[model samples]
Every structure is written in C-alpha cells, then in structure tokens.
Target: MGLALKPTDTLIVIDLQNDFCPGGALAVNDGDTIVPLVNRLQQQFRHVVLTQDWHPAGHISFASAHPDKQPFELIQLGYGPQVLWPDHCVQASTGAAFHPGLETTRAELMVRKGYNPQVDSYSAFLDNDHATPTGLAGALRERGLGRLFFCGLAYDYCVFYSAVDAVAQGFEAYVIEDACRAIDLHGSKAAAKQTMVELGVHLISSDDLL
Candidate 1:
C-alpha cells in the first residue's frame, strides 16, 4: 500500500535553481529530467516548501574565491572540509533563479540558503558547519509540520543533508528518490544513501507517495 500524505507532512523542493540544472554552471547529471516529476508530486502535498542555493559573489564555497583552488577540489575551512564549486548561484543572478519550468505557486514557504558569504549551506535546515540554522526547523515546528519529504537537485548533497537534518531535528524524514538527481561526486551518492539508512531517514520512491 502507498503511504498517504497528511497535513503535517511537507514536500521540500531543494535547490531547483537554474545553476543546478543541465547547461548551468554546477549542473548535475540528468537534473532537469526530474522537474516534471517533481511538479506532479507537488500537487499531492498540502504543505510545500522550496529551498534555493542563494550565494553571493566571492562566497567562500566558490573555487574562484581561492587563489589556487579548482572546482571539485577539497579544502579545509573552519567549518571543516568544504568542496570548492564553480561560480554559480550568485545572488540576484540568472543562475540563482529557480528553474523556469518548475511550478512554485503552491509553495507555502521559500527558504533561501547560502546567502551568507562566510558560510556554505547545503542543508536547507542548517549551514554546513551544522550549527547555524536556516530557521526552517523552527518555522516548520511553528506550523506543526513534522513529516518532511525532500526532493530536488543534487540528491547526494543538498537532499541528503536536508533529510539527515530533518531526522536530527526529530522530524519524520523521507527522500523521494525518483524526484531527485545526484552530482554523485566520488561515490558520495552510495555513501550518502548508506548513511541516511543508518540514520533512519527513509529512502522512498515517488510512486510510494502517489
């Protein structure tokens, strides 16, 4: 039997910005293909939240900010290991905008993360250091929303971190597999899935919700 969505359940569409889609700066593999599926899935949820990767130019996470670093190279920041990324998702830029074809009218909240030039935010709920919050947890609690279903670009990073943080915050967390795509850097996808399972975050399919 399929799982039924409830009023307390929320669908978190994460980082569906132009930069994460094909032909953009930090494009993920087959990321654009899931848009239609995500749009259709959004219709079934009572509460929908959207997340954007809104970074500033010269953001610490960008490879260009480091004199000798290259994209995909890892560097140690005060927050810990940080993956240097190509310049993308600059605030107020085209790449920072949501994918044009994505349906957003139903979203009850839009949480923009990574806006701070000092920190790199992958999880919608918290910054990369895992300390500074995006205020999403409090907002969801205020609305009495507990169960969270996550879907969007770069499943191995943003989606994975968000779902893990959801479980950490005492919410029922699930990741809709088909509605997500992965950057999968250095086997991170497999590793993330394993960690999520160990952490009690459910890995499910969109059909399960449908």
Candidate 2:
C-alpha cells in the first residue's frame, strides 16, 4: 500500500486547461502526453483537486498588454522578475476552460487562479507577490491532506511552483514527472529539475504509482 495514497493525501492537477495543451496558445512541449496518465491517476485518489490558470483577457503577464514587449520578455512585477506570456487562458473564454475530455472522476474541488489583472499567479498557493493566497494551501490543510501528489502542464512553471509552495507550506509534496509536461525554455527544464531536487521535492514517474 506504499504511496497508494490515503484520505489524508491529495492529488493536485495543476493548469490542465486548453491554453496549455498542444495546439493551444502557450502550449507546452509534450503537453498532451500526460493527459491520459493523469486521467488514470485520478482514480487512485479520493481527494482530487484541479487548478486552472484563469487570467483575465488583459492580464499584466501578457506582453501584448505592454505594447512593445514580446512574449517571454522579462518584466518587473511586485514579486520580482516575471516573464511576459503570449495572451492565453483569458477567463470565461473557451481557451481558459479545462480540457473537457479529461477523466475528472475524483476532482472534488476546482481552484481557479490568476483572475487579478495586476498579478500573475503561478503557484496554486500564493500569487507571485507572496501576499495574496489562492486559498489552496488552507483548503488542503483544513482537509488534513498531508501528502500532496502534483501533476499537470508545464513542469517548469505552474506545476513546479505549486509543488515547491506545497512543501514550503508544510505538505509533503511529490511531483509526478511522467504526469507533467515542460515548457523547456532554453534549458529551463534542466534547471527546473535541479531546483526541485534542491527544494526536496520528490520526483516520481507515473509508472511508480501504477
């Protein structure tokens, strides 16, 4: 029964939205690869949560909003350096919707983040400012979810931040590498792996669970 999960553990699916999928805006490399595995993993956890990067149309993270700025341009935001993204995941738009094709059987809660036009929220726990919480950590705490298993798009961004923040918030966090995809920003994948290792995030493949 090792790592088979319990009522005290949670499966957190981060940013499984249309804009992050293959062929969508801001699509991650190999983003489609992990969907089926994540869908399958859903059956193994009783408390499953799904996160959506639900940004407004004119989000501050968008380079287009800054006129001369291009996608991936570095910008100064409150927390520190923030990358400008191509316009994506505009709230209430079709691209912001979760992939309906996913097997979301165990998803008990859906957490929506980045609704604020002024801030970009990569971590499911806290917005980049480290000021406003998305309330996810408290939700997990209230539910007594000590062991957090994370999956989803772009291993370099949302998934990584969420996993790191989970551990920082006192939840034992595991990142299912095989259940996550990467944006791979010019060796960022390698860097992200190193960062996770240093953060004490357990890296497990999907096959480890199966």
Candidate 3:
C-alpha cells in the first residue's frame, strides 16, 4: 500500500553533502546515486528540511585530531563510545556544501550539525552526547510538523540516528530505505535498522511515498 504524505508531515534530507558523496573525503559508496531520488521525494512533501554535517577543522570526530588514531576506530568519550572518522566536511570547505545536484529550493529550513569541535553530531535533532539540542525539534514543532520522513547519506549512521531521534522527540519517524546508501561498517547497517525498529521508527521505502 502507498503512503499518502500529509501536509503537516516533514521530509528531512539528511547530509546530502559533498563529503558524503562520490569523490568526497569520506564518501559512502554510491552515495551520489540517491540524490536524484531524494530530489524527487522532496516534492511530495509540503514541508522539507535539509541537514548538513558542518564540522570545523580538527573536529573531535576526526581521526586526525587524535594522535595515532585512524578512521572507524572506536574510542570512549564523556557520553559514550565514539567513532573517529576520516577528515571531511570542514566548515567553509567544498565538502561541507550540499550535493551540487540536490534540489534545495524546496527546503524550508536547513539545520547544520557537528559544528561543535568538542562533540560529533549524527542525529539532526541532537548531538551524539544526547544532551545538546540542535534546535531541529523545536523548529519542527513550531511549524506544526510532527511526522518526519528521513532519507539521504549513510543509512547506518546519520540517517539511522536521525530517525531514532525523531521518534524520541515525539515525532512519528519513517526511513525511506531505498533513498539512502550505507557505509555498513561491521554490520552497522543491520544494527542500526534493528535499533531504529525497536525504538519505533518505521522502515519504509521510497515507493511507499512516491
């Protein structure tokens, strides 16, 4: 059965940035392939929000910031375990910009995350510490947008976390699976989907909406 998008429902395009695409510093395999579908999906929603992974140079999530560390290694932080990543998406850099082919004109709001050098932000609603609010929740609430549909980037990380956070923030969350790609490090994609499903996130596909 097809899902009809309500006017009050919001579509969140997560981290469709240069760094997460092909030829980027930290590219997800075939990440660029989803851009056209995402562009099409956005048109079905009356409200659209775009998120960017706007990190600063030497951000805490980068392996380069930690001596002798390499990308994908896990380390414990004040909040919990953290995954260090390759240097990417620095502020004011090409990698931080939206994917060149992504349609942004339909987006009513843009949320930039991971700018805080002390923490890494995967969820569009909250930083990884699970304390700091990125203000996305409040913004959506104020606009009366309660149901959130998420897509874009690595399905195992940002997209997964965002959908989880959306449910936690009192919004109905759905993941359009076919509209996303995944890094899938060590079965992380499978792990993320299970967690999201357990947490009340609806895992659907682009065909469900379009």
Candidate 4:
C-alpha cells in the first residue's frame, strides 16, 4: 500500500550534511545509508524542508572549546545537559556542506541551526535554550503545513528533538525510522523513542509510508 500524503504534510530533512556521514568528524553508524532513501522520499512530498548544522568555528558545543572536555562528554550548560561534540560542521567548511549525494534541489526551504556560538541547537524549531525559535514553526504555519514527517541524520538527537518540538508546536509529527541514523550514545536512542511515544509522535518506517 502506498502512503497517502496530504496537502498539509511536509517532510523535514535534518542535518544531512557531510560531517555526519561516513568518515565525518563525528560519524553516526551507516549514516550515509539513508541518503538514497531520503532522496527517493523527497519525490513523494510536496513540501520539503532541509536543515543544516552550520556551526561556527570554536562553537561552544565543541568539546575542543573546553580544554578539559572530550568529545561525547556531557557538560552542564545553563539550558541543560549539553553534549560536547567534536568540531564538525564549522561554517563555510566542506564538512558543514550538505552531502553531495542528497537530492536537495527539491527542498522548498533550508533552515540553518546551531550558528550561535553560545548555544547548541538540536531541534530545528528552536535552539537548545528552547526559547529561541528557528522560524521553522512560523514558516510551516505560514505555508499551512500541519503534518511533519522527519528523516535524516542522528535519530537520537536532531531528528528526535525536531519531532518532539513539532508536536509541541501543534503539528502532527512522524519519524521515518529507516530513513534516519542514530548516535545511540548510552541508550539515548531508546530513551528518545520512549519520549516520542509519550509525546505522541508516531514512529514509522519507510515501508509503512510506501
């Protein structure tokens, strides 16, 4: 059965950049594997939005910014627990560029996040502070898009958070399982799934959508 897409549905592709793919500074396992599926999926959606990590050099989220910290280490920031990542998507750097393999031309809007040196942004809707809106919600609302279908890199982080925030913003959200890869650090993937269930975000696979 083919998945029926409504006129109000929008596909949000999160952080499908080079730095999150194979051989990336902080690679997620099999991250590149989703590119083909995402490319195909884009053809099925009328409205598509892509997100870029787009961090600046020496961004506060980088573990290298803190002398004593190492990548993947958790540090307490004013907003909450911040994951110290390796310097990956530095702005204007090749690593920060979208994967050449991705079909980005079909996307209607491209939202750049995590640009502020003082804050880390995982969800495309808002910065980690949860106060600064990324204008994504407003864009969707303006377009009258209500149901958000998400797919892209790092299911446990960006994709997960984006889906949660979508619901919080009064949109029906769904995550395409096979089209996302996860860092899964210390059971984060499992925890994210549980949280999504509680928040009423639907977890589905591309097969279900097909």
Off by over 4 Å in 4: none
Q: What lDDT is reached at residue 80 by model 1?
A: 98
* 120 Cα displacement, candidate 4 (Å): 0.1
Report lDDT per candidate.
0.95, 0.87, 0.93, 0.94
Candidate 1: segments with Cα more than 4 A from true spot: none
Write model 4 residue lDDT over 85-185, tens digit each, in one string.
Answer: 99999999989999999998889899999999999999999999999999999999997999999999899999999999999999999999999999999
Considering only N, C-alpha and C atoms within 3 Å, which residue pairs clash in candidate 2?
none
Query: Quick one: best lDDT, which candidate?
Result: 1
Local lDDT at 139 for model 2? 81
lDDT of 2 by residue, 86-144 (tens): 99999898888887777766788989999989999999899998789999888878878
Q: TM-score for each prediction?
A: 0.99, 0.96, 0.98, 0.98
Judging by lDDT, tell me the better candidate of 1 and 3. 1
Q: Taking the tens digit of each residue's C-alpha lDDT, what string does model 3 give over 39-157? A: 99988999999999999999999999999899999999888999999999999999999999999999989999999999999999999999999999998898889999999988999
Clashing residue pairs in candidate 3 (N, C-alpha, C atoms within 3 angstroms): none
